[model samples]
Target: MNADFPFRIVGFDLDGTLLDTSGDLAAAVNHALTSVGRPALSVEEVRPMIGGGARHMLAQGMAATGGCTEGELDVLQRRLLDYYAANIADKTQPFPGCLAALDNLTGRGVRLAVVTNKLEHLAREVLDALHLTSRFDAIIGGDTMGPGRGKPAPDPVLAMVQRCGGGSAAFVGDSVYDVQSAQAAGLPVVACSFGFLQQPVETLGAEAVIDHYDELIPTLVRLGSAA
Candidate 1:
């Protein structure tokens, strides 16, 4: 580890960074589509839409179904949320090497936390289902932290730092929103190459882009040293 690096806490985005929840999310989207008399989206078709919140996913599903009026979309969004909540952990799992990477960090005395745009209940359900609830020192979801505090804003990441006892921190995520949030929080960020990045990961201005969880420790060490 780089002795000069000031980081003590590492905040991760749940869905794309640590867990591969695309399968479950796609299933829920298709369920909503079927309920609304629309065609189901294939797994590949829904992968790119996974990082955003349920509203964004529902909006994309609506567009795919030829666009609904705002009121109609609201109904569909509610239904989609219900359906997704019912199936929250049907197929969710940690990405390859995620548990090992987290374990290494924990063993080395680094605090770990999750800051996600996902609904708090669902996020906790997925983590519990994957037996990962015990791994985090803190978990902040979009709904639990009150309004005016989601991704693309520094509130959630900053809150995570405060919850972890307030120290230097890093945020790991896969989207421009995460990059922006980390920047706003004045935290170094590591972007995941395999997450649902809508644009090139390099364009997000992350300190490093990691293709695998196994690279996390070494990258952190390198970044910490540089810092």
Candidate 2:
């Protein structure tokens, strides 16, 4: 939406965008539920509830179990977090072309960062597991730098840009939350159709919607050339 900025720094959403981590996340959620004598959620049921944050995911999981009281939800959330922490990398992995895309972007001199609602420690673990920890110039997690606002608020994305020297940046992600955050930050948004978007990716009002990471390099190149 912000054509004046064009593109320089590229920020990414972690969970569903770069990594297909539903398998492990769902497993952790179910593990927590089982520990508390609750039922487990199927992978499909847990996938859509992701991207918001761990509390949201835990709330959804508890809701699926016929609603827990406020205190109960808090207890469940803590247990789920502990379980998730222990199994963060069980079956989690980067989506196809994610690493290649990061490599290509870095090779082409694109400044990169990650802005996500995931917790910093868990996010770091995922990136480290994929050996991608060094690829990003910055990683702004949900709980990083205190409990600032989360996605759907521009704070995280804007913070990433500010930390990366505040040049032209593009936010790349899979959901409406990412689009909204980018817009709020006055950055152009790029939606990836291949990620876990709850609705059609086109509805996010991004500057462009790409289905593959390989398409990203040429798109940014075209934007740079145009600028």
TM-score of each: 0.95, 0.91
The parts of candidate 2 lying over 4 Å away from their true place are 1-6, 222-227
Full-model lDDT for every candidate: 0.86, 0.83
lDDT of 1 at 150: 85
Residues 1-227 of candidate 2 have per-residue lDDT tens digits of 23433466899999888898899889978876787788888999888888888888888888888777888778878888888887788898888888888876666666789988889888998888778888888998888856758888888898898888877788889888899988899887778888776788888898888888878867766655655
| TM value for model 1 | 0.95
The ten-residue window of minimal lDDT in model 2 covers: 1-10
Give the clashing pairs for model 2: none
